[model samples]
Target: MYQESSFKHDAAPPMEYFLWIIPTGRASDAYGYSQAKTPTWSDYIRETGNNGADRDDFDDAIDFMAWFVYKTHKVNSISKWDAYAQYLNYHEGWGGYKRGTYKKKSG
Candidate 1:
């Protein structure tokens, strides 16, 4: 939450939601405190049955983040408490992490 949006509820306003795009030419579609992208958010909604979830809503954001981290652990085998690895997975999708895409970044 803090890393994603500094806990700002309106991190990505509804009208200007398309502003946050990934450098890879991918439309991030990320919004709110959780900074969750549309496809992933929809997956969360479908998986958890949280049909009314809103990214800007604190409770919903927290739930979405928790669910994401939980899924990260299940799919990536990264410990939930391992903030570093979890963050990497969070930033890079699970498939990207699995493919070592983070290692390709020229730091």
Candidate 2:
């Protein structure tokens, strides 16, 4: 349930992502952490390149994501919780997400 844009490491921010960008960062407040705010690619600055130039593939990402979903508070213990809820918790702050803001969405 990880989310991210398709912007490349060296690509300039596109207009479509402007609304997703927060103050000097993405909606998740992940600025310098992610390469171009590409959601699926987690943060690991001081590395070689985008998602790192070395370690090929999503193994690192998958491992980290597993830990994130299982270790993060609130999102883990919520009843009937699933990847969708976890995604909401991840995108919105805990307080905001716990308010059930997404329940009103048309989606």
Candidate 3:
């Protein structure tokens, strides 16, 4: 999340991400300190019953990240201590990671 948003509550992706990253116009609806996408954020709210959570709120952001990490581990059997794998999961999403999409990337 820090790498995604630089710890800024209002961090947003650069214009090019919106212009070219996705054919729809943006990489995702990711925003704020956690850079959480709308669908995932909504899931967090639904799963945790944190209906009032805000992306720009530090506490909410941290809690959202923790929940994502927990879910990543639970759904993917990824060790929480595995930062590299966790990071790939974070960026690629649980399903994407499970599908081994990261293996196709050159980086």
Candidate 4:
């Protein structure tokens, strides 16, 4: 998706944890943009925070999106995806997360 690519290029590279952020951005965008007739994953990333003072929240959104994508696409096993989904739920209070698998979360 275009949005996924934008988040990867625009947001992921600047972070100390680029791998972590990409999937979060993707998942958050997937959920947040679902209502649109033509939703973009990037729009979801953009919508997660205000212009300022919510950078942490924005980061969390990115992780959430990434987690969503990881669960849905990259891994082929339901058990693995469920574990990831649980991890995201548990880590919602923080902006950081660890990847359970090494595969890139997006296409």
- lDDT of each candidate versus the true structure: 0.87, 0.43, 0.88, 0.37
lDDT of each residue in 1-107, candidate 4, tens digit only = 22423433323222234576553333332222111111333433465543342222445445545554554433333344565554443333122234434233444
Give the runs in model 2 whose Cα sits over 4 Å from its true position: 6-57, 73-76, 79-81, 103-107
* Candidate 4: residue 88 lDDT (0-100): 45
Clashing pairs in 2: 4-39
Decide which is better by TM-score, 2 or 3. Answer: 3
Go through the candidates in order and give the C-alpha RMSD of each one to the true structure. 5.0, 7.8, 3.4, 13.6
lDDT of 1 by residue, 6-105 (tens): 9998786344334565333435578888999888999999999999999889999999989999999999999999999999998998999999999999
**Which model scores highest in lDDT?**
3
* lDDT tens readout by residue for model 2, 26-70: 333232212223433343323224445211334544444444455
RMSD over all Cα atoms, model 2 = 7.8
Model 3 segments beyond 4 Å from truth?
16-25
- In model 4, state the lDDT of residue 55: 23
Q: Which is superior by lDDT, 2 or 4?
A: 2
Clashes of each: 0, 1, 0, 10
Q: Which candidate is the best by TM-score?
A: 3
Q: Using TM-score as the measure, what is the rank order of every candidate, best first?
A: 3, 1, 2, 4
By lDDT, the better pick of 1 and 3 is 3
TM-score versus the correct structure, for each prediction: 0.82, 0.40, 0.86, 0.20
